[model samples]
Target: MTKITLNAEARSDLGKGASRRLRRNANLVPAVVYGGDKAPQSISLLAKDFAKALENEATFSSVISLTIDGKAEDVVIKALQRHPAKSFVLHADFVRVVAGQKMTTSVPLHFINAENSVGVKQQGGEVSHVISEVEVSCEAKDLPEFIEVDLSNVEVGQILHLSDLKLPKGVQLVALAHGNNLAVANIHASRAE
Candidate 1:
């Protein structure tokens, strides 16, 4: 598990005006920490620090230690609002993580052996990643950085679904539990003529 830690300051100044001032003058991103048994807390993180933490894809799925006002809390990235064109994070939302509690969050999917898969190696097929991520429910300790999809034996025209995935112990696919077996990826026959 990749451990990530973020240092933040509790934000007393709230609302659009204060947020704008923080971003313009202090280069901070306003965020909220909610969930668990406590009331929501308003906080602000340095824009560069936030961006740097975000540089790691695992930061989204792994448990992050957010220290606010000298106290540390475990949280997961919930929602992020970004500048439409600039693509920089504007506002962020995070949900507190409890040790024994289960949380629902999306984790990136890694397609392994795609180039070596029988379909691509001998059948002239290409791997099509229909989905890049999947939502899962698990404890903070069981949360995975990524789920691997092995395509070594997949044949051409074979479609892999959510239920087809081999999940780690304690990790459950939200869609599969709800009876929605979504298509994950597939090996499509090459169209090259």
Candidate 2:
């Protein structure tokens, strides 16, 4: 996995005005780092650099090395707020990650061999995805950016449940932990007009 690093500065100014100034004057995005054992710290990240890093889909799930005031902290993006109409990032929230400690995060799912699935190819069925991502709990070291679901053997009228997912070592699906075996995807026969 590729590691991502973001440089930021600790901010003393707080409130909507200060944040507005940072964004309008400095083109910076306000963010906060919370979790672990330390108090939450307010910081500002460069909007240009942050936008570049966000271009990669895996960045959200991967561990990010955040350097604030020359001190580096391992963190993950817990939440992000963006402008509803504009393509601008307004605020970001990060959660500190401690090694060997378990954390829950959503990981993207990739369905492979769907086009060649028995249901679609032989049975003239349509492939449908019920969920594109799943929440998983695991230590930082065991975290996976995405999960793969093989659909080559799936047949028409068959639904793949959460239990059918093959999780990586040391990783557990959050839904399965609570006994929620939700359907992830399925193949259905097309209706004739």
Candidate 3:
């Protein structure tokens, strides 16, 4: 996983009015960094810079190195608020990360060789992905940007479940035993004309 560097400034003001003012004048993004033993600190970041950092899909789950007033901190994005009409970021929540501690995050899934799968090519079947991402628990450094699912030999009517995934080293899926049925992909038979 790669780290995104963002510079933030501590904001002492609170409330909707102050946030709106910041957005109107400076084009700043109101955000909060919480978690760990420290109290959540309210901060503001440049809207353009923050938007650039968020351009990557992995930004939501990947570890970020935040530089606040020259001090660097390891954190992960926990939540985001975007404008309903324009889709611009309105607020963001970040969680502080501690080394050696396990973190839970949803990692994106990428399918490979789906077009070449025997089920689709030979059996006239269609591949349907049930889950586009899965929640995983692991050390921040062990987090994978995306999990690849292979469909080379999947046959029609076969369903790929969470247990069938081959996770990276040190990564573990977070789920109850019964939840393992969460299907990742399925091959459906196609109708003949």
Candidate 4:
């Protein structure tokens, strides 16, 4: 898995007014880190630096190395609040990762060779994705950035469910024992009709 580096500073003040002032004057993003049996700490990061780190989708879904006041820690982005109109991040949440402990997280699913699929090309069918991400359980070190789904030979009307996917070592899908359908690819009639 890839890691993203971020520099953060301890924040003393709290509440909406303080956060607004911090953003308006200092261009800082108010964030909090909680997890791993440690007390939650309020922190702030430069808006530009935080935006730059978020440009990579992997950073949102993968483990990251955050440097807070010169101390480095392994963490993952748990949640983010965004301004509804401008779509700017209002606040962010970080969860500290503990080594050797199993954690559940959502990982993106990447489709491979969809255009070359027989069902899509020769059969005049479209590939539909039911789920873009899947929840999986694994150790922090064994977490994957994304899971790949192959659609080379998928035929029309074929549905690929969660149970059909092959998970990597140390990773297991978090779902009911009966296994709900997590459609990776589905062949639908083309729109030309």
Instruction: Output the lDDT of residue 29, model 1.
Output: 97
Q: Give model 2's TM-score versus the native structure.
A: 0.98
For 1-193, candidate 3 gives per-residue lDDT tens digits of: 6778899999999999999999999999999999888899999999999998888987877899998888999998888899999999999999999899988878899999899998999988999999898888989889888999999989999998888899999998886333665789989998778
What are the lDDT figures for the candidates, one per model? 0.95, 0.96, 0.90, 0.88
Candidate RMSDs in Å, in order, are 0.7, 0.8, 1.4, 1.4
Residues 40-134, model 4: lDDT tens digits: 99999899998988888788678889899999988889899988998778899999999999888888899887899989889988999988988
Which pairs of residues clash in candidate 1, taking residues 3 or more apart in a chain or in different chains? none
lDDT of 4 at 7: 93
User: For model 1, what is the alpha-carbon lDDT of residue 176?
Assistant: 90
Better of 2 and 3 by lDDT: 2
TM-score of each prediction: 0.98, 0.98, 0.94, 0.95
Residues 1-193, candidate 1: write the lDDT tens digits: 9999999999899999999999999999999999999999999999999999999999989999999989999999999999999999999999999879999999999999999999999998999999999999999999999999999999998998998899999999999999999999999988867
Lowest lDDT 10-residue stretch of candidate 4:
176-185
Task: Compare candidates 1 and 4 on TM-score and give the better one.
Answer: 1
Task: Give, for candidate 1, the lowest lDDT window spanning 10 residues.
Answer: 184-193
